[model samples]
Target chain A: MKEFLVISGKGGTGKTSITAGFAALAGDIVLADCDVDAANLHMLLEPVTYHTEEFIGSRKATIDPTHCSNCRLCQESCRFNAITSTEIACTVNPLSCEGCGVCSFVCPKGAITMHDHVSGHWFLSDTRYGPLVHARLGIAEENSGKLVAKVREQAQRIAQEKDVEYILVDGPPGTGCPVISSISGVDLALIVTEPTIAGLHDLERVRQLAGHFDVPVMVCINKYDLDEAYTRKIELYCQKQQIELAGRIPFDRNVVSALVRGIPAVAYAAPSTSENSAAKAIGDVWQAVRNRLLA
Target chain B: MLITIASGKGGTGKTTVAVNLALTLKELLPVVLLDCDVEEPNVHLFLQPVVNESEKVMTTVPKIDGNKCDGCGKCSEFCAFNAIAIVKGKPITFPELCHSCRGCTLVCPTGAITETPRQIGLVEKGTWSVIKTAKGTLKIGSPLAPMVVDAVRNTAPLHHGDQAVIIDASPGTSCAVVAAAKDTDFCLLVTEPTPFGLNDLTLAVELAKKLGLPHGVVINRAGLGDHSVYDYCHEADIPILMEIPFDTKYAACYARGGRLVEEFPDLSDRFLKLWDVIQHHAKRHQREEPKT
Candidate 1:
């Protein structure tokens, strides 16, 4: 199966929206919503989960106060500064802990113990478009990158089991761990950006990251008319970088309207409905992506 | 006061709100803007801060001493991150996977393991207009954004009672956002009025509540979606601090990195008013928090 990921280094650049559009257009696809922290593609796909697994992505250190000694060794040894001396005993701040197990290992009293942290849950579900593998990381949870990796692995497994041709992934914002997990090893990464300086800046970072992973990339500028000057700048950047420009999608209120209706813009506003709708532009972008992916 | 601008969803104007709020507050106080979104630090683009200082944020990775002669597998077995593994009777380390816990060094029976600093990101400090700005940029392929965020947060004297530090946190309620929200006096959760925005706003609110932060909401693009976001705030007792109406002209201006307060001076009053509400709620919450 060919895995195609839609990512934007910056948030809110229409990664999920565009990925959902691809889901609607692609044949024999397994959708993977790797934006586990703030997953929005499930809202559009209407997934009815058939399988769910609790993801123990990492471990958290906890202190057994009954056997504790006030040596402060765990506090000093901790690189994360997650351990602190409370009035009663030394405590582990769950949020600050990186679950490295050093505190547990170095504790003189053996008071600190490492336990599996139920960081998130991944789901295998049936959607109108196809099968979807998505996840929801617990609130204020760490290890989102691991959860994303789990989702991708499960999606790829399902794709292989069902002989699916394409794995369309909706990635999170930022070039952080989760973005890396989602975009790395993909057959193609379609970076969704906008005609803003912020967009251009973040696009460079994402492009560099894609290059770091040796992942092939194509750029698609959303809201191309918002700033024609910056749009030209982005076009120039693409030209200089030798990256393919898939297409430019116009800013359309209908996209949000479609989102409110819980449907893809292409499905909500068919290409035949209007000559210059965002839906038409999306269809063209998909065709471009498909042609390149199949090539 | 330390105020964090964050959102659960991306592209909801966290940087816009942060930059403009700092610029507006700079007129009345010494304001600092720290962009903690290391993976994609965008505030620097809009602020145009001429960075005068740069510091490398480093984490320790094991440096194996091959001459120590014995390749006991104990270090590999003791590593929690699987960053070290016994390869060809030797311990091989993957620095990217290391959490800098120093566990492997302690577990090495042959005393072959040592620690070395690896740069994961960079912290840049500079000034833009009257605002002191600092930002963190993670090395392209590194995953240690939270570490960089902590470094950026420490670049300024955040404890000055008379100073205002505005932190533009990364989107989503994850580790990076958690690092930015730490020790903040208040959090301004920015969101738009849409299903996706509301869905993620609820998550961001949950994170704020979990952190026990005094937070309020700013509704950007108020006229774009529906009343669900407003209803969520009303139901949750989150004060709606400010509202920037949906205007294409403002959006276009922002696209070119134009400051709202500079392009339209009338908006400064709105941000100032936003500060007023934030001050009122933040102080009230602070006073009540001590008792809890």
Candidate 2:
């Protein structure tokens, strides 16, 4: 089985919309939303969750007040400054803690202990298209990369159990840890970019990240008509890099309407002819992607 | 006051709101715009500032001395990130995966481990007219974005009595956003009107609440989607700070790396109004907090 990840280096470049459209077109596929920090594919897929699990991705240091004697050693030893000392006692800030266990080790009184924090929840669900695996990380939570990895692992397991041929992953934005976790080991990464300077700049960053992981990459310019020149520039960059240009989707209000309606563009009823529709372009992109995956 | 513009969802106009607000407020106050979206800094693209100073942001990682090494594997055992490995009784360090926590050096039985500076990113300070601008650019393939973000925030000039700092945070409520939002007086969350927007906005609101930071929402692309985001805000008692209508003109200007206020001069008043609302909300929230 092959996994195809749809990602954009910058946010709001239509990664989820394009991934949702591909899910609508691709058959025998399991869907995974690895953007655990902001999992939006569930809004489009409307999955009915069959299984749920708490994601204890990391540990948070906690101070036991009962053990008393505030030496403030943990606070001084913590590199993340997660421990705060006041007149009464020292406390741990969960948001700032990296769960590195340095504070607990350095505590003379053995008051600080690492406790497993339930940072998020992962779900296995059934959608209109196929089985789906997704997650929701708690607000201000770290370990999103770990949660994403868990979501993808479950998605791949379900795909294997169901004998599915592909796993379509909706990855998070940026070239950060979560994006790295989502794209790593995937068969192909489909980078959805726009025709803007920010788009081009971020595309290069994510492309470089993909190269670091030795993963093959494909490019698609969403809202290509926004700036013809930038789109041409992106085309040239992709050509020079020997990356496949899977599709160029024109800016379409229908894509927004489809999102507002909480459905994939390919599944939405287009008010006008499909000739110039962004959904049609997405379909062609999916076809190209499927051909490449199969080949 | 330090105000951070953030969104849990990407492409929600965080940078657009931040840049426009900074440009508009520079007329009334000393404004410093810190682009803390280190992984994908874009405010510079729109502002086009003339960078006057650039500094490298470095993080320390453990460098094991091979000659002094009697690798008991203690360093590898103590490393939380698994950045150290003992092969053939020799400690190998993977600086890329290191979190710079100094745990390995402390845990090493021998005096073999030493801390060394590794460049993670760069922070540049510049000016666009009267508005001071600073941004952090993470090195390609580096995963330590929060470190860079903190460096950018640290580079901001000391806040005077009348100075206002506007931080443009990266999308998502991760460590990077936390680093950017830390110590900010208020956060302005930019979102849209769709379900996805509402879902992520809720997460961002929770983040603000957890951080104990006063925050308001600015709904971008207001007409393109449902009223869910507004409904969520109203139900949650979070103030709706502003609403930027979905206009092709604004989109076109943004596509061309142009500022919203510059392209449409009429939007200046709106951004200024946004500043007023933010100040009022921040003041009221601070007053409501009981004295310790």
Candidate 3:
């Protein structure tokens, strides 16, 4: 199967908006939302989860007060400074803990025990587009990278079972663990960037990340007209890098309206002149990703 | 004095404020604006530092010796981060999942698990003469940002009791933020006044409290949302240092790689005073600590 992943180096770069549009155009494909930290693609997909799984992340060391010993050794051993002693009871701040387990080992009384923490939930769902796999995490919870891997696994299985020709994935922003998991073994990465300096800056960063994994990358400039001069600069950068400059999307209010309406450009405003720019942009990106990845 | 500009939510303009502040503050004091947001380091584009120096940031990971293995699976059981997993009589290493804790090494009976250093990223330091901002860039695809931030901060030229050091941190209250905020004198959390901003700001504030750092807010896009954040600040007795208006022209300048304070250097007086208020809070908090 041919796979195409859309990603932004940072948040709010129109990755989902363009991904959902491609989902409308894609046929016989399994959709995956790999942005497990803030998987808002499901908000647009509205997928009904057919299967769910629990993902246990790192564990925190808890001090048992009933152990009848208050040795401050555990407190001192923790480099994270998670454990603090007061007049009454010793406390381990969950937020401060890195789950290093150094405190648990140092406790002579064995009072400090590590307990599994529920990081988040992964789901295999059916959306209008096709079988969709996604996940959601608790606030300030770790282990999003694992959750993203699970989502991709389910999507690949669904695609194989149905003999689908395509597997569309919406990758997370940034070069974090989740992005690493998403980009690994991917056929091609469609990097959605903006025209601003920050956007171009992050584009270079994410491009470097994709380069490490040997993944083919294509760029789509969102709101290119917002800064035409910067847009030109970005074009020059892409040319210098020898990476394809897939498409340029002009600033349009309809993109926001389409998002609020909970439908993609192809579905919500198909044949509408307002979405012509974005529609062309999506098509160009899809074609570039396919040309570079598919045999 | 190292001031870290941080926000809990993504894209609340942490880099914009950091770059501009570094640009503006350089005139008042020698500044080093280290971009601790390794996941998406963007300050390099704005400042375009020359990268006079670069260094690898290494973190320790456990390496198990098969000949010395005891098949106890104790290392796996002892690992809190689940970075080590015993599958089919062999321990698998997940480097990205690893937190660089030496617990597995300490617990190995035969000393099979030993600490090994892996280069996760690089710290690039240079001077931007245009904005007069001395900056550091944390390389991408590297999970260890705090390492770069530490390297940048600990490098020579630290103007103790003199020049101020400002770090632009990654979004969210994660390990990276903790690393950046660990030794800072005070923090300035730039946030919006929206519900998402308020929720994440509360988390960041809790982080500040837990870290024992005095902090105030710079509410950007102040009029866009309700002042519940302001109300919360009042109730918590925290100071609102400054409120940047929702100006598209400012956003345009930011988009064009233009410095807001450069166009209008008068804004530096207000920012510096904001830092003064933070200093005031630090003095007050230090005074409140009981005599040891």
Candidate 4:
């Protein structure tokens, strides 16, 4: 099976819009949104969840008031400063806690207990296009990268079971742990970037990140007409790096309008619509990706 | 005084506020600017610091001695990050996943586990612009940014009576950001007015609370997104340090490699006054309770 992953260097770079187009165009694929922290792919796919499971990424320490006196050893042991001093109760700061469980081991009062907090939830669902795997990491929860990896693994397993030929994965922005988990073992990576200085700069960073894993990547300029000079610069970068430039879409208001309407630009504004130019440009991008992957 | 500019979301003008503030301070005193966005640091592009010297920084990696090799998966079992995996007879380690905590070597019963050096990235130093603002650039592949931040802090120029050190940190309240603001006296978080911006700014504020770093806010593209950011600041009792409007000309100059202090000469006096306010607040905060 030929798998394709899409990622962007920064937010609002039109990665989801283009990924939605590929989902609408591709057939018989397991679609997934690896950007669990800020996932919006479900807005377009309209995936009807068939399976849902709570994801407990890490353990949290809770003080059992009935257990014993507040010896304060657990509070002293917590490097995260999670334990409250005035309340006389040791509570884990959801954002501060790293799930190290050191407090449990260090508690002399034996009042501290570890509990599995439902950090987030993962979903396996049926979308209009096909089966979709999406997830939502809870507020102030750590281990987003791990949750992303789990969801991707589930998607890959489902794709393998059904003998699906493609897994269109919508990866996260940035070159952090989550992005690394998303791009690993993917056949092709579509790095969507803008035609701006920071756009090109972060593009090179993520591109190098993908290169470290030896993953083949292609470039897609989302707002090419915004800055022709930077777009040409990105093209040169792709050529110099031997990475293919898939295609470019001129800046259009219809793209955002289509998003607010909850539909892929290509389907909502195909060849016969006012957004025909933008839709056709996306078609050309898919054509290039197809020739690069299927050929 | 040490001031750090940070944000939770990217492209929210962390570097812009940082470089501009640093330049504005340069007119007041000797300024040192450290870019802690090691993942994909673009501050250098704006600061354009000339490379005075370069040094390679490395992280501790596990070294397996083949002669002392016992193919036991003890190290793999002890790894919390799933970095160490024993496939068949050979043990494999993913560098990106390793947190360099040396847990594997501690758990390995056999003498096979040893410390080895792995160069994650570089910490290069020079001066930013003609004003000689000290700066650093972290390469892309190097994941050990916190280490570099610590290193920079160790060697960071002091405030020197009247001078102040301003740090431009990476987005997100991760270990890297913590490392960047380790010993900072105060911090200013730059953010736009958006849902993502608010979410991240609140998270960053929580981080500052944990770290006990007195901080304020700098609202970039202030009027574009929403006023909820203002409401959030008021509710949290955090001061709005500075506000840069959604001026297309300013953004265009920033995009075209024009320094804000250079374009808006009036900003220099404003930033100087900002420094005075920060100094007063930091002093008042520190003096709130005298240490016995």
Candidate 5:
């Protein structure tokens, strides 16, 4: 199956909306929302969960006060500064811990032990369009990249079992761990960007990341009419980079209106008059992406 | 006071709020603006700071000495990240997977492992119109954003007791956001009015609460969506500090890299007022806190 990912290096650039629009158009494709930290695609698809799994992200070092050895070794050896030692005991800050086992290894008293922390939950659900694999990372939790990988693995498994032709993934913003995990091993990465300096700057960064991973990339400029000059600049950059420019979606109020109604633009827009709407532009983008995938 | 501009969802004007607020606060006091969104930092794009110093952010990965050692597999067994594996009595390392914890080096029985610095990103120190600015830029494929963020946060000048440190955090309530918002005097959670925005804003608020930060909301694109966000803030008892309505003109100006406070003189006064409200809320929050 072809793995298709919709991502924006910058957040709130209509990545999920566009991904949901593709879901509305491409029936029965395996869907994965890899933005575990702040997943929003599920709001549009309204998936009914069929399977759920607890995500044990990483191990955090904990000290047993009963052992009574406050040698301060764990506190000093922890590179993350997650441990704070008082005269009576040492405590680990869950938010600060990177889950590296150095503290446990360095403890002379063997008081520190590494325990697996359940950071989040992933779900396999049936949406109106297909089976969706999504997750919710715990508040202020670490290892979002690992959770993203879990979501993609489950989505790929479901796709393989059902013999689906495509797996559409809604990726997170920023060129960070989660975005890297989402784009890794994907067949095509459609970067959704906007017409702004921030958009262009972040697009360049994420595009470089995709290139670093040797992933084929296509560009879709959302809110292309917001700044015509920046749009032209982006088009020129894409041309210079030899990257394919898939489609340009104009600034459309219907996009937000559909979002406010908790539905995909393709589903909410009137079919008869959607020729010039954001929904239509998304359909064109989907077609372009599909053609590229098949090619 | 250290104030962080953050959002659960991206593109909700974290950088916009941070830059404008820094500019506004600079008029009253010394301000230091930190772009802690290392993954896709955009405050530099908005402020266009002249970088005075650029320092490489490094993480150490274990380098195994093959000639001096027998592969005991202890390092592999002790590694939490599974970055090292012993195959046929030879230990192999994956640098990308390594967390640079130095556990493997300590666990090696043969004393054949040493640390090597790997460049993950860079932290740039600069000045933007009297605002001391710093930003971190993670390498293209690097995933160690929190380390870069920490470096940027550390780059702030010491002895600025009266200056306001404004941190522009990346979206999502994950480790990176926490690294930016943690220990800040206050957090400004920016959001829109849509259901998606509300859903993510709730998570962001939970993060702020968990961090014990006094937070207020800044509603961007106020008229674009529904009232669910307002209801959420009201139900949660969180104050709405500012609202920038959904206007094409404002968006167009922002798209062209124009500061809202500069292009629209009225917004300057609004941001100034917003700062006063934040200071008051922070003070009241401190007063209401129970003794530790």
Candidate 6:
């Protein structure tokens, strides 16, 4: 099955909205919300989870008070400054620790030990489109990249088992570890960006990142009418980079109202209107993306 | 006071709030605006700071010496990031995957592994009008965002005890956000009124609570969705510091790379009021904390 990833280097550029639209258009597909830290795709798809598992992405160092010596060695050797010493005892701050195990290794009294931390939870769910694999990392948790990789792996496994046609991944924002994990090894990376200076700047960054990983990238300008000049600039940039322009979607209040109603724009069955302009644009974009993927 | 502007979800106006607040406060105080959203920083676009100096941000990765190596494979075993592998009885290092934890260098029994500096990004310093500005930009493929964030924070100009330092943090509640929000006096979490906004705002609120930082909320695009975000904040006892109405003019100004305070001078007073509220909260938090 071909895996298509929807990513935006900058946040709040409608990546999840476009991904949800693709899920509605693609028939036989498994959806994966790889934005583990802030997974919003499940909100639109409304998945019913069948299986759930705790994800222990890393370990945290904890102080065992039973063998307390208050030597302060662990506090000194820790690069993260996670260990704190007081008049009473020494303790480890889990938020500051990166689980490098340096404090545990340097503890002369053997008071520090590394324990597995359940940083997040992943689920295998059934959505209206197909099987969905998604996860939620705990608040203030690290290791989001690891959690994203796990979600992608589970989605691919379900796609192979069910003989699905595609795996549409809604990626996290930014060019950080989580975004890298989501876009790496994907068949095509479709970037959803707005027509703005920040959007253009971030598009270049994410496009360069995709090129580094040797993945083909396509661009979709969301809210293109907000600035016609900037939209033209984006078009020129895509042409210069030899990247395909999937489609341009105008800003629409119907899209926001559709999200408020907890559904994709394409799936919005308004009584008065059959299809919104944004949904129609997304339909065309999906057709072009499908043709490219098949080729 | 070091005030960090953050949001759990992307595109929620963290940069807008931060840039406006810094510009407004700079009229009354020396302000330093540090953009810690290293991976995809947008503050520079609005501020239009003319960069005066830039420094490369580097991280230390393991450099294995083949001649001194006995091929124990211990370095690979200790690497948590899977950056090292024992191939053909020799250790091969992948610098991009390395977290720069120095675990392999400490655990190498053969003493063949050494640390070397690898450039990950750049931290730039400049000024936009009266406000001193700094931003971090990660090299396109690098995954070590927190390292660049730290570099940006470290390179910021030193502020006096009374000056304001506003940081625009990256989206999401991960290590990058932690690096930006650490040791800040207050955090202004910007969000919209949508369900996605509320869901992510909840996580961001939890992060602020975990870090023991005093925080308030600034709702952007106020009329776009329901009142669930305000209700969640009310139930959670999180103060709604300010609200900016959803306006197409604001979107157009942002699209044109114009500052909010510049386009709408009235916003200056609102941002100044935001500073007062943040100070009030910070003072209240200080009074509640016990002296060591």
Write down the TM-score for model 6. 0.97
Candidate 5 residue spans exceeding 4 A from truth:
A271-274, B290-292
lDDT of each: 0.90, 0.89, 0.75, 0.74, 0.90, 0.90
Model 3: residue B190 alpha-carbon error in angstroms? 5.1
Candidate 2 interface CA RMSD, Å: 1.3
| B4-69 per-residue lDDT for model 6 (tens digits) | 999999999999999889889887999999999999999889988989999999888889889988
* Interface RMSD in angstroms for candidate 3: 3.7
User: Across residues B42-117, which tens digit of lDDT does each residue of candidate 5 receive?
Assistant: 8877789999999999999999999966988998998888789999999899887788889888888889999999
Q: State TM-scores per candidate.
A: 0.98, 0.96, 0.78, 0.77, 0.98, 0.97
Write the residue-wise lDDT of candidate 3 on B127-236 in tens digits. 77733233335545555455565666566355545666777777766556777776577888888775546656777787687677888888886666566788888998
Question: Could you tell which candidate, 1 or 2, scores higher by lDDT?
Answer: 1
Winner on TM-score (2 vs 3): 2
Error of 6 at B32 (Å): 0.8
Clash pairs of candidate 4?
B120-B142
Better of 1 and 2 by DockQ: 1
lDDT pick, better of 2 and 6: 6
Candidate 6 residues lying further than 4 Å off, grouped into runs, are: A65-71, A87-89, A271-276, B156-160, B290-292
Report the candidate with higher DockQ, 4 versus 5.
5
Q: Alpha-carbon error at A149 in model 1, in Å?
A: 0.8
Per-residue lDDT tens digits for candidate 5, residues A1-295, read 9999999899999999999999999876999999999999999987899889899998877889988388888888888999898889898988888888888788878888888899999998998899999999999998889999999999889999999999999999998889888988899999999999889999999999999999999999999988889999999999999999999998888888888888998888554455667888999999999899999
- When summed lDDT is taken over every stretch of 10 residues in candidate 5 chain A, the lowest stretch is A268-277
Number of clashes in every candidate structure? 1, 0, 0, 1, 1, 1
All candidates: DockQ: 0.86, 0.73, 0.33, 0.18, 0.86, 0.76
**Residue A225 error, candidate 1, Å:** 1.5
Ranking by DockQ: 5, 1, 6, 2, 3, 4
* Candidate 4 off by > 4 Å: A10-12, A20-30, A36-144, A158-165, A253-283, B129-145, B157-163, B181-187, B193-219, B222-243, B264-292
Best by DockQ: 5
